[model samples]
Target: MSVKIRLQRHGKKQKPFYWIVAADARSKRDGKYLEKLGTYNPNTNPATIDLNLDQAVQWLHNGAQPTDTAKAILSYKGALLKHHLDGGVRKGALTQEQADAKLAKWLEEKAGKVDTKKEGLSKAQEVAKAKALKAEKEANDKRAAAAVEAAKVEEEVAVEETPEVAAEETPEVVAEVAVEETPEVALEETVAEVAPEETPAAEETSEETEA
Candidate 1:
């Protein structure tokens, strides 16, 4: 029976996630598989891949032909490199101990690279968040300043209206005071005129009696 390495679709539509499997060549795409080697999820920021390195390399050594996508996945996880080292050991070009040392060193270097990439991504996300916060603060400040300006203009308009209202009331108050004073002056003049007429009549009567 021919063996093959391929992806088995598992997640929902438009959000695809897969399982790496070693199966019989005649099996359907998502049908029963001989062995599950790993998982792949592309929903994450840098995509997530998890593989059983020993099992995958063993399958490769057992003559399992991997599909193009599965091959790339295996390469990324260093399964292909490990297989190459094992082949070199079998061919007597290198000892098993030397191959193990080389693989350990390579895995260490790859880990350091992954750590650096994660750090860079974290820093970028922080910067983007800070920028968004700053923009929101600036927008809030602008709105506050505009509200203050509008209030000040309304206050000024009210102040101006109050003086105009006072000016209009002043003329009415002055006219009322003038009307009250005119009535008192007219009464005084009438009393003076009556007293002069009475004095003249008394003088005339006395003059006639003396004659």
Candidate 2:
């Protein structure tokens, strides 16, 4: 049976993760796999790929036909480079030791590049977090300042209103009290004049009755 290298669909709906595998060409897409090569998760920043370089290269040497996506994955993980080195070994163009050295060097370089990318992402995330925090603090300060200003304005309005309310009420109360005192004072003056005239009449009547 002819063999094929392909990806098996897994994970959940709308979020797909995949497994790279070598399987029989006649098998269903997810039914049976000859060997599980590795896993692929595209939900990450760098789109994670954990592939077995040696196994994938072995599968390639055994004439396993890889699907396009699987081939790309193999190429990205240096499996294709290993396959090329194995071919060079077969043709006596290079020794096995040289091939291994070259592969090791390449993997080291790739690892360094991946590390650099991760560091860059980490720094970017830190900067974004700091910026968000600063913005939030600034917004809170503005709100607090606005609250203080509003309180001050309300206090000033209350101060302005208190005097006006007192001024408006005081005059009406004083005028009503003054109007009541004016009537009492007029009646007291009239009673004093009548008392003087009655005293004089009483004295004259007493003198006349005695005589």
lDDT of prediction 2: 0.94
Give the per-residue lDDT of model 2 (tens digit) for 8-41: 9999998899999999999999898889989999
- Where does model 2 exceed 4 Å of error? 172-211
Worst 10 residues of 1 by lDDT: 40-49
Segments of candidate 1 deviating more than 4 angstroms: 165-211
- The CA lDDT at 147 in model 2 is 100
Instruction: Report how far off residue 79 is in candidate 2 (Å).
Output: 0.1
Tens digit per residue, CA lDDT, model 1, 144-210: 9999999999999999999999999999999999899988998899898899999989999999999
